[model samples]
Target: MQNEKRDQLVVSKKTYKKSNELINAMGKGTALSQKLFAIGMQNIKVDETNNVVATIYGTELRKMFKSSSGSLYEHIEALCDRQIKGATIFDWNLLMKDKENGKIEAHQVVTDASFKNGTLTLRYNNSLTDKIVNLQKDYTVLSLADTLSLKSVYSLRLYEMLKSAYDYQRAVTKMQGEMVFEYKLTELKLELGIINSGGSKEIKTELEKEFPDYDRIDELAEKTGQTKYKEYKIFNRNVLSKAKEELNKKTSLQVDYEPIKNGRKTEGIRFFVTKKDAEAVEKTAEVAVNKDEILDDLIDLMHDDFKLREIRELAELAEYDYDKIKKSYDYMNSYSSPVDVPIAFMKDCIKNEYYNNKTTKFRPKSSNSFNNFEQRNDYDFEELEKKLLDN
Candidate 1:
C-alpha cells in the first residue's frame, strides 16, 4: 500500500496506515514486565523462513541508556527477556482478509519469541509474512528511518498511535482539513504496552531485576491500587507526558493532547500533531526540527549529563557542527586517562578549536601565573620528547 499512489490507496473503516517508526517506537517503559519494548522491528520482513531476528548492539544502545561497561549487556539481555518472556504476548496481531468476500480476518502476530546468544528470534506458526498475509485488510509499509532514531520507548509508542490515528483520520476526512486523532484511555494504555498487571508474578519479578532504578513502579503501584500502572493519572505521568517531551525534542512531529470525557469522567485522548517543518516551528532553521535533533544526538554521545546552558555553550563553541563535536567526543573517549569532567573537557576542546584548527589561548585575568611552551623556559623539553618516544 505504501508503494501505491496516495490518491489510489484504499482505506478500510476499521484499519489504518502507520509509519514503521511509530510502530517500532510504541514500546514504553511504563508497560507491564517490559511492555515498552523497542527492538528495531522496522527490519522485520516476514517470509517463508517463519522467523524474524531483531538485533541491537550494546554500543548503539548506549546512546539511549546511561550504562556502565559490561553492565549494558546484562541489561540488554534482561530487556529481551522482559519483551518476550514466559506467558507474555503468547501471540501477535495476525489478521488476514477473505479476498473473495472482501472481509478481514485475524491471526497471531508471532507464535513465540526466544532470546539467546544476544539475539532475539520471533517465530511464526504459519507463513504469514507482510507480503502474503491477508489480515482483514492489506498492510501499509511506511518509511522506517524516523522511528529508528527515537530513544524513548514511550515516545516511539505515542508516535505510532498518533501517526496511525492521524493517517486513519486523514483518510476519513479525504486528506483535507485540520486533523486530530482520538483514542480511548484503555486503548491508549494498551498501545503503550501497559497491560493489566497480575498475569504472572513470578515472571514479573524476574523481569524487574533488569531495570534497577524502576522502584517508582512499585511506589505508584501501591498508590494506584493495582498493577500494570496503578491508574490513568499515574500512567500519564510515567508514560504519556514523558513520551510527549521526548517526541517534541527528538522527532519531526510536534505533539499536543487534550482529555475527553464521558459525562465528566475522563475517558480518552484527543491529540494534535503537526509537522514541525511545515508549521514554521519556533527558531526555524532550514529544517526547523533538525536543529534540536542534531543537538540531541550530540548530547546523547556525551559521557555525562550536561545542563542545557552548557550544551548550548558547547554548540556555540563547536560552531554548531555535528561532525566536529562527534569526532572530538570519540577522540576524548579513546584516552587512557579518563578526563575528570567530560562536558567540561568537550567545551574546552571546542573552544580551543583542537581538531586541526588552532585558536588563541584564553585565560582568566584572575590567574596569577601563565606559561607559553615556546616563550617560557620550560623544563627539559628535549627530555620530555625523549621520554614520550621511549614510552
Candidate 2:
C-alpha cells in the first residue's frame, strides 16, 4: 500500500509549458514554496470557458516535503505572502507580426489559499494564468520531474533560465546553433534572486516602488532581513557553480560557464549548454535504469529534438519491438528530406504502421530547414523593454 501510494505521487514523468516571460520572471520564494508553486502550475486545469484552479492534497505535499520540519499547513499559509516582483513586457514586434506589444504582471501568484481536511486549495492570479494558458509562441517546456528533483532554489531557477534561453535559441530565433547564454553580471544576479533590491539608483528606486515601506536597502534589510550573495566570488562558488554541477549531473542538460571580464572587473557570464546523449540519460534517473536495454538503444538511434521522457514513453509503447521501431525511425530519417517536425511524423509512422512494406521516399507537405542559421542579430527592443519594465 505504501508503494502504491508513493507511485501515485510520482511526478518525474510529467511536464508543463510556460511562456518565456514567466520563465524569466523575477520571482522570489523559498525553495519549498517554489516547488509547490511549480507543482500547482503543473496541475492547473482549464475548462472550455477557460476557468482554472489547482488543488494540492496534503498527502502528496507531505510525501514531497517529508524532509521538511514543522507543520505543512504553516507552509501553505506562508505561500500567500510570496510575490513575483516584476512585470514582463513581451515584444511581439520582434516576431514581425501586426499585433501590438503586450504587458502582464502579477504581484502575487497564489492569490488565495486555504487548507481544510488535509488538502490545500490555491487560486492563481488571472494575469499569471494568462501568460501560461493558450500560449501560441515564445514558450519553454518545464519538466516537473526535473523541478522536483532539484533541491536548491538557485538550481531550479538557473535550470529554468538556461532551459528557456536554450529553447529560444532553438525555436523562435531559429538559430539551430549550439546553446549559449550571455547575461550581464548584475542582471544575472537579479534573475537568480541573489542580490535583490540593489544596483544603481534607478534600479533601487524602481524596486522600492514594489514595496513602499522599504524604500532604502538598509531599511528593507532591517525590516525583512534580506539574504543576498553580495560578493561575486562567493556567489560564483556557492550559487552558480553548485547549480551548474547539479544541473549537469542530474538533469537532461549539461552546462558550463565562465565570467566575462571588463578591464579588471567581472562584468558578465557566458554559459554553454547541451543536451545529454544516451549514455548520460542512462546514468541519471531510476526510471531510465528500470527500462529495458532496448530503450537506451532506441534513444541512441533517435534525434535530439525528441525529449528523453517522450522517447521513454515511445519505447514502452513499442513494447521492446526493436525491429519494428527501428524500421519506422529509418523510414522517417531516410525520407527525401527532413520533416518539419520529425517527432510527430515518427509517432504517426509507428502508430499507423506506415513502416510496413514501405519502399518509396516519403515527402512532407512542407519542411523548414534548420541548417546554416545565424545567431539572433537584434536585441535592441527586447533589451530596452526589459530594462524599462523589469524591476
Candidate 3:
C-alpha cells in the first residue's frame, strides 16, 4: 500500500509538471499575449476587469491610487480609460474556457502603462494573451472559498486547543477539592519521606542527629522562649496534633469547612516543568503545548491560522483593495482563536463581515501619465456630513 501511494504521488508530480509545461508553452510569443487578452476580455464581460488588475498589482497599486483603494474594478476601468487609452478590453468567454481547463490561472493584472512595452499587460494569468482581458468571475468566488477553508481549519484547531486548556484547568481545580491542615501536613510528610527514603535515613532520628549542628533550629527555639530541646519538641507535637485532630474530625463528620484563615488563598498551583514534558501532554490534551525551546510557536500558529488565504485570493480576483484588505486583516486580528470567544464564533464573525460589506477602498488605477495622475477620493462627503450631523 505504501509503495502504491508513493507511486501515485510520483505520477501526480509528473502530471503537474506536464501541465505546467503545456501552460507555459501556451503563454509564449503572440500566442501568450493573445490568450491573456482573451481571458481579460472574459473578465471585462463579467465586469470583473478590476478584479484581474487587483490580482496582478495587489495592494501596491491600491496604495498608489488611494481614491479607489477598496474598489479594484473601478480602478481598472479608470486605468483603461486614462492609461491604456481604452485599447485593452476583456474577452470573458475565452478566459472562462481557459480557467475551466486549468490552462490559465488568474493571479493578478498589471495596469501600469509601462507594462509590456507601454501596452497594459495582464501580467500573471497563465492563459493566452487574447484571454488576458477576460476575467473569470466564478474563479474569484472559488478562490475566496478556498482561502476561507484553509483559514477555518487552522482557526478551529487552535480554538479547540485553547478550549481544552481552559477545561483542563477547571478539571484540575475540581480534583483538588480542599486543602486542610492535615492535608498540608500529609503533603509535607510525603515530601520529607521522599527526601529521607532517597538517603536511607530515618527522618526523626536524622533530624535529632542534625539538630545540634543547625544553629537556626537553636535560634528559632530561643526566639520562641523554649529553652530545652525536649520542651520545644513537646510544644511542636501538641500544636500539630491539635490541628490534625480538628481536620480529621471535620472530614469524618462530613462537615464542610474552609481551612484557610486570615490570608489570601490560591485557587490553583503553578509549577515549572521541562518543555519535553509539556509537549508530551499537549499532544494528547489539545492544548498549546510545546518544548520550551520553541516558545514562539503559539504566536506563529495563531497568526497563520487567522489570516485567511481566501481573502487575499478574493482581493486578487477583484483587483487588490488595500483598504478592504486592511479592514479585513484588522477584523481577523481582533478576534484571534486563542484570545477571542471561540473558533466557530471567530469564523462566523469574519465571514459575515467579509460577505456583507459592499464597498472596499483598496485598489487604485493609474492615470494616463504619471506626471498628470489625479488623486482618487475614497470618502463620500455627502454621506460623511449626514453621519456627522446625525451623531
Candidate 4:
C-alpha cells in the first residue's frame, strides 16, 4: 500500500511535460486557468481554528481573479473545479516500521486539500512531519522543450552541436595535422549550411540521405584530424616521412660494445723488481746529489720552523759574504714561514759551488788578517767565526 502511494508521488517525464504544457497554456490567459494558477502561487497558512486561509490584499486578489462577487470560498471552489481542468488531488500517507523487532511503530496521513478561504493546503500528521517537510523543500516545477517555440529549441540544440564540432576541430589540428581534421571541417560545413539554408525537416532528410555517413565521419574526424581540413592529408604525410628519416638515421649510427666479464683478468705482461735493485737505485741517486744540492735540501727541510738559522747555515757552507747572506735571508723571511726556495737560488748555488771547486785560488774573506777583516766586516770576529763554523 505504501509502495503504491510512493509510486504515485514520483512524477515521470510525461507527467512533467503535461504540467509544463498546463503552465504555458495558462500563461496564454484562460480566465479559470489563470485563477487556478494564481491560487497555487499564493502562500497558505493555518489559523487558530485549524482552518487554512489564503491571504492577499483584497484589491490584489480581485485584480488577479477578475472577480468581486460571492464569498472568497465560493470563488476558490469554482476556480478549483473549473480552472484546474483535469487536475486531481491525492491523499498520501507515511508509515514507519521497525525492522529490528518487526513492529508497525508509527502511521500517519498526509493529504492535499483546498481550504475554505481558497488556500491550497497539504497537511501531515505530527508523526509524518519530517517526511512532509523534506518533500516540500525538494519540490520543483517541471520544464519541457515543447513549452517553448520549436524554432527556439532547435536553434539552441544546433548552436551546441556547432560549438562542439568547432572545439573538436581545434583539438585535432593541434595533435596530428589539418588533414586529420578534414572530417570535422566537413561536418561543420554541413551543419552551417543547414543552419543558413533554413533548418527545414525536408532539407534535413535530403542532406542525411546524401551524407549517409555524416555522424560516423564527424566523430572519427574529430578524433583524427589535426587542425584544418585543407592541410590534413599533406601535414600527416610530411610528419610521417620526417619521422621515418629520423628513425633511419638513428638506426644507422655506429656503436662499439665492450663485453663484460665476471672477474678481472690481466692480458698484458707484468714485471717485478727486487729489493736489491731498489737499494742500488737509491744509492746512485744519493751519489748524484752534490754538496750544493745537499745544502739546498737541508735548507728546505729546516726553513719552516727555523728560517734565519737555515739561511745562516746555507751562507756559511756556501762561503757567501755576510752582507749578501743577510740580504738573502731578509728577502726569504719577507715571504710566509713555510718558504719554497726559488729554483733560481738552487741553480746559482750549484754554479757558485762549481766555480769555487774549479778555481782553487778562491779564498774566504774572513781568512784575511783580523784588522783587514775588521775593516771590511761590520760584525765582530768571534761572532762571524762562530756562525761560519757552527754548521
Candidate 5:
C-alpha cells in the first residue's frame, strides 16, 4: 500500500475547499505555521490506512520560502517543535447538531506528527475529518498561493474570515447584492487571538490575572506594555489596519471596515469585502511556464516587467484570441523607444485595436503616451514596414 499522500501539482496556487466552520477556526499559529496548515489542507489525501494525512518536505519548504540551506533546517526544526509543543492550536468551538448550543472542543489537529529524513508527516484528529474532509456545502474555496503570501497571522486569519464570508454571500445567499459582515468587537478580538475569551471562567480569570495590564493603552503603557490591543484605537491601529493593508496589497480581496459605535464607545466592526478579477494573488508562487502555451509562454517571455497578476489580467484581456494579444505584445516589444508602463500601453493597444493598424507605425512622443504618438528622428520605418508587409 502506498503511504505517501501529497499533491502532485508543482505549483502551490491550486485551490482547496474547507467547510465554513473550519475556515473560521480560531486556532492560532505563527505566520509560517498557518501557511503550513494551509499547505497541509492543499495536500490532504487518504493514506494507506484510510486516515487523512499530509506529508511536507524540507526541500519543498525551502523552495517555497526561498530560504538558505543552513537556516532552512533550523526553521523546519523550529516548526516541528512548535507543532509538538501544541503551539499551533486547532481548538475550536464547533456548533452542535442542535444548532442552539456550542461546544468547546480542544483537539490536536496533528494527532500524530513525525519528522524523518527532512520530511514531516502529520495525521489529523479523527473528530475533524468531517469538517476538513467530508464537505457537502457551505464550504469556502481558497488559493494556497494567496494564503501563503500573507506575512502576519492576523492578516491570514482575517483574510480567511472575509473570504469565507464573501463566498458564502455570493454563492449560498445568491442575493445579488453587496456582501458585508458585522462582528462584535470582542468577538473579532477573540477570533484574531488579540484577547483570550476561553470557554471556562477559570481560564479567562487566569489570563486576566496574568495580563493585568492587558487593557492599558495609555501614553505610558503605549511605550512599554505587557499585553496587546486592549484599547479599540490600539487594536485598530495594530491588527485591523495592518491586516487590511496586507490583504489589499497581497491577496485578491479588497476589504474595508467601519467601527460600529454607541455613545462614543466602539461596539462592533462592519466589513465590506469584494473580490478582484483575473489577478488573485501575488506572483511569488510562480507556476513553471510552458513555452508552447500562449498565456503561460507570454507570461514567461514578456520583456516588460509585470506582477504574475498583471500578466494574468493581460491574458484575460486576450479573450481567447491569443494571436491578437501576441500581436499587441509584439507591437509593444518591437517599439524602438522604451515604454514607461508596458502593461498600461499593452492594455490600451489591445483595447483600442492598435495592434491591427498596419498602414502607419505609431511612435509615442513621450513615455506616458497611450492615446497619441509622434514620429521620432531615429524611427526604424524600414524595419517596421518590412515587418508589417511580412505579416
Candidate 6:
C-alpha cells in the first residue's frame, strides 16, 4: 500500500466533488493530508457571515484512515495537531494569469481548522471562498470506491488527473466506458507531482530572469537519479509505465498510452482509458432492461459465438425465455457481481441460475474481487507473452 493506503472516503456514503480550480491550488501534501482534505469536502455550509464552512466529524475522519498507515485514532490526533497548531499552514494559492496586465492575480485561501471532541470544522478565508465555491457547479466527483484501493500518492495523483480530465462524464447519453486524452508530457508530469508548475517559454524566461539561478536542482536530481524527466525514454520507463501498472492492477480503469511524436522525437502522451462497469465491480446498482426488446435484439447485443452459447446455456438452465435470459445478463452486469472472467463466471452463474431466477442476486463477496481477478488475468497474459517471445 505504498507507505500509505489509498484514501478511501469511508467517512460517509455521500460522494464529494470539488472544482478543478480548487484542487489545482492545493500545493504538495502527503496522501494522508489529501485524505483529510477529501473528508472535509463532504459537505459545505454557508455561515451567518456568508463564509463557506465544511465540517467533518472525528468518527468519520477516523473511518477515512481506518485501514491506512497507523491507528485511526492516532492519525486523527496527529492530523488535527498539524492542522490546528502547526506554524506553517498549507494555504491555498488560487492564481489567475492577467495577460493584459502582465501580472498574476493570486488569492490565498487560508484555512482555519479546529478539532474538538471528534469533530473538525473548517472556516475558509473569505477573500476567495466565494469564487472557489462558485466553481463547484463545474466539479469532478472522485470515485470513492476506486480510491480506497489506491496504494501510493503518485497513483492517487494520477488517478485524479485521469478522472478530472479524461474519464469524467461530459454528457448524459454517452457511454461511460472509455475515454482518450492527450496531455503534454510536462503537464502530465506536473499532474503526477513529478515537478513544480511550468508555463510558456516567455513566462519561463521572464521568471528565470526575475529569480536567482536554481538550475543546480537539476544537477542534484541527476546525481540522485531523479533525472527530472528530461529524457523521453526514461520518463516513459520510470513514470508512465509504473503508473499504468499500478492502476491497471489495482483500480477499475485500464490505462495505456501512445506517444505523441514530434517527427523524430516523443513530445506528449495520448492516453487510452477504459473504465470497468462500476455497477458490475461494486455489485450494487440496479438497472432496468427493456422488456419490449425481442430475443433477436438481445442476441445481437451478445454478438459472439461464445457469448451466444453462454446465453443459451443460461436460457436452458433457468428455463427462461430469451427475453428473460437477456434481463439476467443485464442484471448480472448491473445488480449481481462483476464479470472479470466473463466466460468462467458465466458458467458459474449458469450452474447457479436458479439462485438468480427471482430477479437479482449478490455473488460471493471478494473484497474488490474484480481487481483480484484482473491482476490474475494480467499475470497470465504476461506469461503468455513471454512464452510467445521465447518461441
Q: For model 4, how does the per-residue alpha-carbon lDDT over 1-391 read when each residue is reduced to its tens digit?
A: 2432232223112112112112111001122222232333344455454533344444444333223323434434433342443322221221233335433232323233454543444443444333322233322232111111011212222222322333344455653221111223333333322111122334334333434354443344344442332243442344323323322222111112121222562111111111123344334323322322334444454344343344545555555443344444444444334333333343244335433343322222322243322232232333322222121
Off by over 4 Å in 2: 1-10, 46-52, 62-106, 172-178, 197-201, 204-227, 287-391
TM-score of each: 0.46, 0.56, 0.14, 0.17, 0.59, 0.53
lDDT of each: 0.47, 0.60, 0.28, 0.31, 0.60, 0.51
TM-score-wise, the better of 3 and 5 is: 5
Output the lDDT of residue 375, model 3. Answer: 40
| Model 5 segments more than 4 A misplaced | 1-12, 47-51, 82-101, 175-178, 202-227, 279-391
Candidate ranking (lDDT, best to worst): 5, 2, 6, 1, 4, 3
Off by over 4 Å in 6: 1-13, 23-27, 48-51, 67-71, 80-110, 131-136, 167-169, 172-177, 197-229, 249-252, 283-391
Give each prediction's root-mean-square deviation over alpha carbons: 14.4, 20.7, 30.4, 46.2, 13.9, 15.7
Clashing pairs in 2: none
Winner by lDDT between candidate 6 and candidate 5: 5
Q: Which candidate tops lDDT?
A: 5
Residue 343: error of model 1 in Å? 8.7
The superposed Cα distance between candidate 6 and the true structure at residue 260, in angstroms, equals 2.1
Clashes of each: 17, 0, 62, 11, 0, 1
lDDT of 3 at 56: 28
Evaluate residue 361 in candidate 5 and report its C-alpha lDDT on the 0 to 100 scale: 49
Model 1 lDDT-worst window of ten: 5-14
lDDT per residue as tens, model 6, 266-311: 7679988877665544432111011112222444555442333344
Query: Of the pair 2 and 4, which is ahead by TM-score?
Result: 2
Model 3 vs truth, CA RMSD? 30.4
Candidate 3 shows a clash count of: 62
lDDT, model 3, position 327 = 49
Candidate 2 C-alpha lDDT tens digits along 1-391: 3443354247555778777776676546545545666667756776444445677887677555432223345445433433422221110001111123322222455555666777777665554567657788888888776776676678888888998888777776766546888987656765676545432344445443533232244344434445466566987988989999878766778899998898877877899988777566546755422342455466567634454456656676776677878888878766766577665676667777777757644444454557423244432333222211111
Supply the global lDDT for candidate 1: 0.47
